[model samples]
Target: MTGIVNDAGNAATYAYDASGNISSVARGNAAVSILGFSPGSGAVGSNVTISGCGFSATPSQNTVQINGAAGTVISASSTQLVVQVPAAATNGPISVTSPSGSATSSASFAVTQSSAPLIGGFSPTIGTPGTAVSVSGSNFQTTVNENSLVFNTRTALLSAATATSLTTAVPTFSTSGRLAVTTPFGQTTSSQDFYVPPGAHVVSDVAVTGRMAIGSSQTVSLTTAGKIGLILFDGTAGQRVGLQTTSSSFGSCGTGSLQILGPGGSSLGSTALCNGNYLTAVTLPTTATYTILVAPIGTMTGSVTFTLYDVPADAAATIVPGGSAVTLTTTTPGQSEVLTFSGTSTQRVSLTLSEDSGLGSDCTYISIANPDGTFLVPSTLLCSRNYYSNVLTLPATGTYTIKLRPYGTNKGSGTFTLYNVARRRDGDDCPWWPRDHADHHGSRAGRVSDLQWICGPARKPHHESGQHSLVLLVDFEARRYGPLSLRGLWEQYIRRATDLASDWHIYHPPCALR
Candidate 1:
């Protein structure tokens, strides 16, 4: 505190709070000492040097600031640091900071704004996602986020900056254009164009294509054969949408060559209208703009009517085992309805999908999507209609979706019900169901309905655990099984352990199962 040094050894200065008390993120190591800085005043984007002791040789490790605005360190040594005056820097004292500590200059460092930033060049003109590109500029905000850099329209991540330089990477899904930098004053672009390959940018960010919602219709004219007319719609992944078209030349039925292109310009789904109308459904892969390209089948010119609609699915409706039945309806043969149920990994659930109209499989096509949106069962309209009853042990503990598609050419409704009571497929439906084995007291075990448990609320009870297995026991031999009381069950367990010539130890159970 008594040294002649008025600057930080790392090339920054101690910061003062509102009350003039010093406040800084830097903690000075006793080894750090700042002597002074040369050319104490400089304009924004200009460089100055500080003479110090115990500074870092690594440039980035040494932090320098003009007043409160942080500057980027371009070079450093154990005793000297060269730093640029940051954009947004005003007239104030300069400071230097490192891992050791911070020290302020006794005199103020003047910050002058001579002009807006200028981009001279960026090395290696090929702009691709993740490629490191360094930009030469002037009057740039030295703080990383302060300088807004973009490769074409896509914003690049700013890695480093100084008064006359910027370092960043070409952003993913970026278009080809000159490197552009924007500061508080204004924006500037490089003279040379950075070559980012075309098409990649269109594929990743097709967000705002049209203002059309479900049930809206639009018309576009196809003048000649093979002429593609594109309509844009914004959609997200895991969504299913339907497309239908009508033209006077093609009749009232959906007739036209329509193809869907994803944001990345990849084909999602397409259908060609020959002598008949065409309709199809699609599930999107990512959130972006999807293009519906309409083309005439022949050399006929007409205004085509196109309608976009959502596939009906109630994803919010959840049901419990033996809960109220849910009715799924569809107007088209290929349409499907989605319903969900929450289940655990250890649970075995049963589902029944029936048609009271005696159509059975003719009215229902049932498949499932797991918690992660992967298909558990891929149900199709082309599949044979049969009674859909599945008893399966769930894969994970989350909401499992059931896709109930209406099968056959005739569309109607189907009743769906879910049940938690299911037998294990390994042939041991109820492994814990007590067997009426003759004990020393000749007690007969009574049976209850499927998997009726008297335990937990969230976790599954271990069948082998003594305390859990006790709850599964009924009053088969009421008095012989120790009156079914908690204490009586303990005594019966001890007596039975001796009778069965087995060692049954009492263990504490969580006693909670979903």
Candidate 2:
């Protein structure tokens, strides 16, 4: 095949092979054409495939340049060629040339860095100020000048680094945010956020209890603004722990508060500002180390006394019908002892508390509580007296708690006896109501009439029955006035009844007069 073209008044002839392929073209100059290229953009040292109409079949003679840098040709064909981007290449147009002519691409090829930094993960994801954390990744430079670690936009001081790992101290101002590492190539950010612990003062368990004193105060230094002082204690489940703070002598320093924080920094309980003293108690939720955070609410600058007490576990004992009496004593002010006993519904129990004669103060009491920490009967106060006793009928079918504590601020020792009482037959000692056949011809006074009939003589009773009957009468009177107020009307009635019963016992007086 042959074709003719007029080139500058000179006739140029183009010849083709019998297979319809270009054999040789007689033109003034060798022209080149660029159609397209695969992967139009790449980084340095990356292999790029360029496709266009070209004249060269030998790859070594063909030259490819990107961004003014010479590219190494890997292979060449009549319509396609592969070349490696030079290391010094920049973002610019690509050019290809042969011994015949040269062709420039219409589009530019982007030349970027070879490898970007990648983050795998970091150790000690949660930390506080000055905490050292190790970050592991790839493409990190060993030189400090070329590599940098940033936490929440704050630059961290690098201690050491390798190609895949870096060690740095957490910045003081760092917060909870993404961590990023930057190199000469590019920057890579962590997939998750690193956690920074809330600022707090680290304190030991012994330091909290041994240093702070009552009445006398001590200064608590804070490291940062609004900082909380943390005290850690190892605790067991089912243990009762008490925290009390004496009134602050800050004078004008400002107010502060205390909180019981759980294992995970959750608030369990707190105390209110009462004068300067605050008290709180909690039963441990789990057998683990717990954190107590003492934070200032306003301006905290004064001295305060902090106290912690671990209440002993309740020593439980069981009592049956006509069981032997058991005695307990209060060892400290506000100290409590718990006794557990099981009984069916409507079972009657008699509890007796007698102050030790050797002691001068009458500051002791006893209370009955249900299984779920609710009061079944209010507490009984036995102050300024030698002996006190009461009888209660159980209302629920479960274990009952007999709680004994000191009556007032002073800790006074006393002996307490508890036993199950058999319900009196024939209703002789029934202090609640009169018997069925007995005449109800008394004044209509509410509790007064009930007290008179219970304390009065039985219709056919004589001998030792009066003593036990009188004891029940006093117990009913004490119950009427509550256990805490055993001194006023109930004591007077007891004194009068004891005198009259003693006279009747010796003289064998008639039932109506007695």
Candidate 3:
């Protein structure tokens, strides 16, 4: 204020001090006005400025309000002022306040959520042709449409829609395999193949009787006479009798008579001798009883004599005390020998017989104490009457005697006879009677011994108390070598097993054998 004053116009003034410093000064006051106020389209925060108001201004008496709400100003000057933009103050008009007044401007900000909806996978991917498939995706809308989901090569309708996924019903398509899916923003496909998965030949009946039988033929079938062949064996080779048919005064009708035709079709023995059902003769070939039909002949009608007898050379057989007699060396039909024995105590004894004639009649019958005839051994002893013959074990050591009983009285004669007897070091006689504990099929305790004879009949039943009169039938028609058709053998095994089970309380295999 201590200076020389210089006055020019009335609106201006200036002054100079004695030390050459200008001391008089004057300020020009201007009214505060927000001429230019703008915000970014998506701008947030309260950073506002009102330029051209004054120079070098500061936030001394200036403040701001975001969205009309009071807020602290960060920086204030003549040109700009900045304040914190509250989170809730987005997308609204912002205001600033100076000493002169307040100014407002339009503003907008982008809004964002915490997260976006998402989906994972679908269950039970397989379905019928026209089934609804569940879709899984992200950012889904409730307004489902064709653009929401898609099916590969199949027409689909969006039946359901949600924020997380949609369900689309599939349409009928002629094709098969994996399917694909798509949406507005992305696409996905199935990794599996769909398909429809595919649905045995089943003998109906069988019948049989005698040598001739009827049944369902297998892969191969035969229908001729010579197509059938027949051979005889005494557990070894075929005998010497040619097969022939006759049509004379004594000729056989239908299938003709079965004669033992020699080399020239001439009857070897008398043709009349071989014309009956069960033959009983003292003189004939051991093979006279074996007349098996070679092929499946449907049904049989005619009959032939099966003669069986005991030759005189087999008499006076060696007998073992308390057991059966020692067999002879003659294999002939109807050829039985007698034995004489004298003893006491009745300890168990056994005998072995040689099957000379395989006519199915090489059995032994003991006349022990008159009408008290039991099988020389259990029928199991006669397992196979072939080359390696059978051994029979007897029970009790006593004065007993027996006779070599031929099977059919016409077949077990001539050639082979009984050898010596031996004992089965392992078990006792087959428990068919008094002793009643053993019942399993594999139990060998009461099998066969060497002193008894399992003659005549097959699979003899075990009896309990008193001595019973037993009659056995020799089965010589079974094959002993190679493969056996055994068509009816199961029925026979069942029959035998049932008999043994009832008599001895044993459980055998079922009625069928493989």
Candidate 4:
């Protein structure tokens, strides 16, 4: 036995065996003490650090019980022991037993049930205000006040809630945004934005009368104009709205066409020529009632079956110059994909269409139109294979619309590139000047003559001596040079002028020639 003084200045005695191993120690009846613990409350399986004195150095020898359940000790020291709350632990005192003795905490450790809520999916993903949408997931509380659902910035009213699902009424102020749910544990938001359409209407089995007369036409009334309307011909897909007659007296059904007339009988779009079967997609330009005029090429009489579906108004995707190529799919026959882009006057805009393979006999059609809805360049001929436009030079600077669709009953997928080409600007001199002059002479001459007439005299002369001398001689023999001679001399002057223009890079000719 040895007498010693503890760090606290308390008298202590140590007893050891013959091997000098300390078997027991007495600290004047000083029992194990628990000062306090961090995070006074925690859920099951939560790690807690209890700070106190009189604990075994070996963690396995120290037994820590939380809420009447044995806690697993992670580490133990003379003054501290880290333990994990055991399963089925309740709210009760935390007691620790060291080799010396045992002691209980002054306060009980709180055990809480907590878990983050999860969302699987929702019903009626989209709806107008005052719509009730049901959400399904897990870890929802049975208590109503504990759950919160929000659509965008507005908090929705919770009608009911379960462990796996929740029902909420869409708030009136909700906009097109994410739907989020918050619980005591955590919060989660939807992966996609809920779309709230502005409005919608559907018309079924609309009877369209096909007329044989050239001027005669039929009309179909629509509730909303300026919106997209999908028309189904003959109650089937991939069919055109027109008369189908077998009589030889009737011309080819391919020649039939329908014109969309505005409320006041104003044409909204260029006539959609029918190819026997038709499913036309049109955007009404006016809110007033509209009509579809059937203009068959030959005498024909038939009742066409059609259904009109009104779709919400949506802006066409804009494709700028040098932008990524756009892939267009003709999901339905005669379905048009509209694209708008800004173009400068004389900008060489070209479109290259490449059809997908295995699409036998299917053709793609592209049409370039002005902002006024008039076709700047009507739909090109059916392109069964890849087709490249003739490098169209924009006539003016404004927004241009490009419509892509499948020709006739052909429907498939294709990709098109709309990009600006770096073309040689127009001038008096030809790009291929002095080489292959004959081949490009006529085009160059026409361009120069048009520019000269439109923009007045050329800024610079083509030939210092020859062209000027010829013009002077023509004037000198004005009377002798007949209309035919004068015309011939004028042609020569235009040819020479274009050559000079090409060299100076004055203005670029229209893309038609390219």
**How far in Å is the alpha carbon of 385 misplaced in model 3?**
3.9
245-323: candidate 3 lDDT, tens digit per residue: 2112222334332332221112333223123322222232332123222222233332232222223445454454334
Candidate 4 lDDT at 204 equals 26
Error of 2 at 293 (Å): 2.2
Q: What lDDT tens digits, residue by residue, belong to model 1 across residues 252-346?
A: 33445666766444567665533223345677776555667655554545566666767654333566765677876666434656688887887
Best by TM-score: 1
User: Candidate 1, which segments miss by more than 4 Å at Cα?
Assistant: 1-63, 68-76, 82-88, 97-216, 236-240, 246-249, 252-255, 272-281, 310-324, 328-335, 339-364, 367-402, 406-413, 417-514
Query: Local distance difference test, per candidate?
Result: 0.59, 0.57, 0.36, 0.54
Tell me how far the alpha carbon of residue 497 in candidate 2 is from the true structure, in angstroms, after superposition.
7.3
| lDDT digits (tens) for residues 37-137 of candidate 2 | 66867776668988655438899988888868999999888667899988888888888898767877656788766577888999876677688899999
TM-score attained by model 4: 0.29
For candidate 1, report its TM-score.
0.43
TM for every model, in the order presented, reads 0.43, 0.42, 0.22, 0.29
Each prediction's Cα RMSD?
18.9, 18.2, 35.0, 18.1
On lDDT, the stronger of 2 and 3 is 2
Between candidates 2 and 4, name the one with more favorable lDDT. 2
Candidate 4 lDDT score at position 448: 18
For candidate 4, give the lDDT: 0.54
lDDT of 1 at 188: 90
Regions more than 4 Å wrong, model 4: 1-276, 282-315, 357-364, 371-376, 425-514
